[model samples]
Target: MPTHFIKLKPSAVDEYKAIHAAVWPGVLAALERAHIVDYSINHYPPLQLLIATMKYVGDDYDADMKKVAEDPETQKWWAATDGMQESFATGATGSGKDIPWWTEVEEVFRFEGTS
Candidate 1:
Protein backbone atom coordinates (compact mmCIF):
# COMPACT_ATOMS: atom_id res chain seq x y z
CA MET A 1 0.00 0.00 0.00
CA PRO A 2 1.21 3.47 -0.84
CA THR A 3 0.03 6.78 0.49
CA HIS A 4 0.46 9.97 -1.53
CA PHE A 5 0.18 13.52 -0.33
CA ILE A 6 -0.69 16.26 -2.76
CA LYS A 7 -1.79 19.84 -2.59
CA LEU A 8 -4.55 21.48 -4.57
CA LYS A 9 -4.56 25.06 -5.64
CA PRO A 10 -6.90 27.21 -3.60
CA SER A 11 -8.97 28.04 -6.64
CA ALA A 12 -9.26 24.44 -7.75
CA VAL A 13 -10.19 22.78 -4.47
CA ASP A 14 -13.90 23.03 -4.97
CA GLU A 15 -13.77 21.81 -8.54
CA TYR A 16 -11.48 18.96 -7.59
CA LYS A 17 -13.87 17.76 -4.92
CA ALA A 18 -16.83 18.10 -7.26
CA ILE A 19 -15.12 16.06 -9.95
CA HIS A 20 -14.28 13.23 -7.57
CA ALA A 21 -17.76 13.28 -6.07
CA ALA A 22 -18.91 11.62 -9.25
CA VAL A 23 -15.89 9.87 -10.62
CA TRP A 24 -16.11 8.71 -14.21
CA PRO A 25 -16.67 5.01 -14.74
CA GLY A 26 -13.87 4.80 -17.26
CA VAL A 27 -11.50 6.30 -14.75
CA LEU A 28 -12.53 3.75 -12.16
CA ALA A 29 -12.10 0.94 -14.63
CA ALA A 30 -8.67 2.16 -15.56
CA LEU A 31 -7.63 2.19 -11.95
CA GLU A 32 -8.87 -1.34 -11.46
CA ARG A 33 -6.97 -2.39 -14.54
CA ALA A 34 -3.89 -0.93 -13.02
CA HIS A 35 -4.37 -3.08 -9.89
CA ILE A 36 -4.95 -0.02 -7.75
CA VAL A 37 -7.36 -0.95 -5.02
CA ASP A 38 -8.76 0.63 -1.90
CA TYR A 39 -8.04 4.02 -3.36
CA SER A 40 -9.31 6.93 -1.39
CA ILE A 41 -8.77 10.67 -1.64
CA ASN A 42 -9.25 12.97 1.30
CA HIS A 43 -9.29 16.74 1.33
CA TYR A 44 -8.23 19.17 4.00
CA PRO A 45 -9.92 22.52 3.45
CA PRO A 46 -7.65 24.48 5.73
CA LEU A 47 -4.49 23.42 3.95
CA GLN A 48 -6.11 22.87 0.57
CA LEU A 49 -4.41 19.54 0.37
CA LEU A 50 -5.46 16.13 -0.90
CA ILE A 51 -4.30 12.87 0.60
CA ALA A 52 -4.60 9.77 -1.55
CA THR A 53 -4.05 6.26 -0.27
CA MET A 54 -4.15 3.11 -2.32
CA LYS A 55 -3.05 -0.50 -2.36
CA TYR A 56 -1.14 -1.66 -5.39
CA VAL A 57 -1.42 -5.36 -5.97
CA GLY A 58 0.38 -5.54 -9.27
CA ASP A 59 3.91 -6.88 -9.48
CA ASP A 60 5.25 -4.14 -11.74
CA TYR A 61 4.31 -0.72 -10.47
CA ASP A 62 5.98 1.18 -13.26
CA ALA A 63 4.44 -0.95 -15.97
CA ASP A 64 0.98 -0.68 -14.48
CA MET A 65 1.37 3.08 -14.20
CA LYS A 66 2.37 3.25 -17.83
CA LYS A 67 -0.66 1.20 -18.78
CA VAL A 68 -2.93 3.54 -16.90
CA ALA A 69 -1.21 6.58 -18.45
CA GLU A 70 -1.77 5.21 -21.95
CA ASP A 71 -5.49 4.78 -21.49
CA PRO A 72 -7.42 7.38 -23.50
CA GLU A 73 -10.14 7.84 -20.93
CA THR A 74 -7.60 8.19 -18.14
CA GLN A 75 -5.68 10.72 -20.21
CA LYS A 76 -8.86 12.69 -20.73
CA TRP A 77 -9.59 12.60 -17.01
CA TRP A 78 -6.08 13.78 -16.20
CA ALA A 79 -6.41 16.57 -18.73
CA ALA A 80 -9.22 17.93 -16.65
CA THR A 81 -7.69 17.14 -13.25
CA ASP A 82 -4.01 17.83 -13.78
CA GLY A 83 -4.58 21.52 -14.21
CA MET A 84 -6.11 21.66 -10.76
CA GLN A 85 -3.07 20.23 -9.00
CA GLU A 86 0.14 21.82 -7.72
CA SER A 87 3.44 20.33 -8.79
CA PHE A 88 6.39 19.82 -6.49
CA ALA A 89 10.11 19.84 -7.12
CA THR A 90 12.21 16.95 -5.84
CA GLY A 91 14.12 18.84 -3.15
CA ALA A 92 15.59 22.16 -2.13
CA THR A 93 18.65 21.64 -4.33
CA GLY A 94 16.70 22.00 -7.59
CA SER A 95 16.72 18.30 -8.41
CA GLY A 96 15.59 17.48 -11.93
CA LYS A 97 13.04 14.96 -10.66
CA ASP A 98 9.71 16.66 -10.48
CA ILE A 99 6.83 14.91 -8.74
CA PRO A 100 3.99 14.76 -11.19
CA TRP A 101 0.95 16.32 -9.60
CA TRP A 102 0.85 14.22 -6.36
CA THR A 103 3.83 14.32 -4.06
CA GLU A 104 4.70 10.96 -2.54
CA VAL A 105 4.70 10.80 1.23
CA GLU A 106 6.52 8.40 3.47
CA GLU A 107 4.24 6.67 5.97
CA VAL A 108 5.58 7.16 9.48
CA PHE A 109 3.18 4.96 11.40
CA ARG A 110 0.33 2.52 10.92
CA PHE A 111 -2.01 0.62 13.25
CA GLU A 112 -4.22 -2.31 12.44
CA GLY A 113 -7.09 -3.53 14.59
CA THR A 114 -7.54 -7.16 15.38
CA SER A 115 -10.96 -8.66 15.30
Candidate 2:
Protein backbone atom coordinates (compact mmCIF):
# COMPACT_ATOMS: atom_id res chain seq x y z
CA MET A 1 0.00 0.00 0.00
CA PRO A 2 1.21 3.48 -0.83
CA THR A 3 -0.08 6.55 0.93
CA HIS A 4 0.18 10.05 -0.42
CA PHE A 5 -0.56 13.44 1.05
CA ILE A 6 -1.53 16.65 -0.68
CA LYS A 7 -3.24 19.88 0.20
CA LEU A 8 -6.44 21.09 -1.39
CA LYS A 9 -7.03 24.72 -2.04
CA PRO A 10 -9.47 25.78 0.65
CA SER A 11 -11.95 26.92 -1.94
CA ALA A 12 -11.86 23.56 -3.68
CA VAL A 13 -12.97 21.28 -0.88
CA ASP A 14 -16.64 20.97 -1.76
CA GLU A 15 -16.08 20.77 -5.47
CA TYR A 16 -13.37 18.21 -5.04
CA LYS A 17 -15.60 16.00 -2.93
CA ALA A 18 -18.41 16.36 -5.43
CA ILE A 19 -16.13 15.39 -8.27
CA HIS A 20 -14.83 12.30 -6.51
CA ALA A 21 -18.32 11.29 -5.49
CA ALA A 22 -18.90 10.35 -9.09
CA VAL A 23 -15.55 9.80 -10.75
CA TRP A 24 -15.63 9.28 -14.49
CA PRO A 25 -16.28 5.69 -15.52
CA GLY A 26 -13.39 5.68 -17.94
CA VAL A 27 -10.98 6.88 -15.27
CA LEU A 28 -12.21 4.24 -12.85
CA ALA A 29 -11.80 1.55 -15.45
CA ALA A 30 -8.30 2.69 -16.26
CA LEU A 31 -7.32 2.61 -12.60
CA GLU A 32 -8.69 -0.90 -12.25
CA ARG A 33 -6.82 -1.98 -15.33
CA ALA A 34 -3.67 -0.59 -13.83
CA HIS A 35 -4.12 -2.91 -10.84
CA ILE A 36 -4.71 -0.09 -8.40
CA VAL A 37 -7.16 -1.25 -5.77
CA ASP A 38 -8.41 -0.51 -2.27
CA TYR A 39 -8.10 3.15 -2.96
CA SER A 40 -9.50 5.82 -0.73
CA ILE A 41 -9.05 9.54 -0.23
CA ASN A 42 -9.94 11.47 2.88
CA HIS A 43 -10.22 15.18 3.39
CA TYR A 44 -9.54 17.28 6.45
CA PRO A 45 -11.52 20.46 6.24
CA PRO A 46 -9.69 22.20 9.02
CA LEU A 47 -6.34 22.00 7.25
CA GLN A 48 -7.59 21.50 3.72
CA LEU A 49 -5.59 18.33 3.46
CA LEU A 50 -6.29 15.35 1.25
CA ILE A 51 -4.79 11.98 2.09
CA ALA A 52 -4.97 9.15 -0.37
CA THR A 53 -3.98 5.51 -0.10
CA MET A 54 -4.07 2.64 -2.54
CA LYS A 55 -2.70 -0.84 -3.01
CA TYR A 56 -0.83 -1.61 -6.19
CA VAL A 57 -1.02 -5.29 -7.01
CA GLY A 58 0.76 -5.38 -10.36
CA ASP A 59 4.11 -7.03 -10.76
CA ASP A 60 5.62 -4.02 -12.50
CA TYR A 61 4.99 -0.93 -10.45
CA ASP A 62 6.55 1.60 -12.77
CA ALA A 63 4.93 0.15 -15.86
CA ASP A 64 1.52 0.01 -14.23
CA MET A 65 1.89 3.61 -13.04
CA LYS A 66 2.97 4.67 -16.49
CA LYS A 67 -0.06 2.95 -17.92
CA VAL A 68 -2.27 4.93 -15.59
CA ALA A 69 -0.47 8.15 -16.43
CA GLU A 70 -0.94 7.48 -20.13
CA ASP A 71 -4.66 6.94 -19.84
CA PRO A 72 -6.40 9.79 -21.67
CA GLU A 73 -9.17 9.93 -19.13
CA THR A 74 -6.70 10.14 -16.27
CA GLN A 75 -4.90 12.93 -17.97
CA LYS A 76 -8.17 14.76 -18.41
CA TRP A 77 -9.06 14.19 -14.81
CA TRP A 78 -5.72 15.63 -13.75
CA ALA A 79 -6.38 18.69 -15.83
CA ALA A 80 -9.56 19.33 -13.88
CA THR A 81 -8.06 18.62 -10.48
CA ASP A 82 -4.65 20.17 -10.81
CA GLY A 83 -5.82 23.68 -10.14
CA MET A 84 -7.67 22.53 -7.07
CA GLN A 85 -4.56 21.15 -5.36
CA GLU A 86 -1.35 22.58 -3.90
CA SER A 87 1.75 20.48 -4.35
CA PHE A 88 3.59 19.45 -1.18
CA ALA A 89 6.97 19.03 -2.77
CA THR A 90 9.98 20.20 -0.73
CA GLY A 91 12.61 18.84 -3.14
CA ALA A 92 13.52 16.16 -0.60
CA THR A 93 12.37 13.13 -2.57
CA GLY A 94 15.19 10.60 -2.94
CA SER A 95 14.76 10.78 -6.70
CA GLY A 96 16.04 14.38 -6.38
CA LYS A 97 13.09 15.60 -8.35
CA ASP A 98 10.06 17.35 -6.99
CA ILE A 99 6.83 15.41 -6.99
CA PRO A 100 4.34 17.40 -9.03
CA TRP A 101 1.26 16.43 -7.07
CA TRP A 102 0.91 14.19 -4.05
CA THR A 103 3.94 13.44 -1.91
CA GLU A 104 4.52 9.90 -0.79
CA VAL A 105 4.46 9.41 3.00
CA GLU A 106 6.87 7.00 4.57
CA GLU A 107 5.22 4.49 6.84
CA VAL A 108 7.03 4.26 10.13
CA PHE A 109 4.68 1.82 11.80
CA ARG A 110 1.50 -0.17 11.28
CA PHE A 111 -0.74 -1.50 14.00
CA GLU A 112 -1.65 -4.76 12.26
CA GLY A 113 1.93 -5.97 12.76
CA THR A 114 2.08 -7.25 9.18
CA SER A 115 1.21 -6.33 5.66
Highest TM-score: give the candidate number: 2
Please state the error at residue 37 of candidate 2 in Å.
1.7
Q: Candidates' lDDT values, in order?
A: 0.78, 0.81
Q: Put down candidate 1 lDDT per residue, 1-115, tens digits, no spaces.
A: 7877666888997789899999999989989999998899888889877888999999998888778878889888888887787666344221112345567788889887896
Q: Encode model 2's per-residue lDDT on 25-88: one tens digit a residue.
A: 9989988998988799998888888999998898997788778778888888888887788877
Candidate 1 at 62: error in angstroms? 1.6
Off by over 4 Å in 1: 90-99
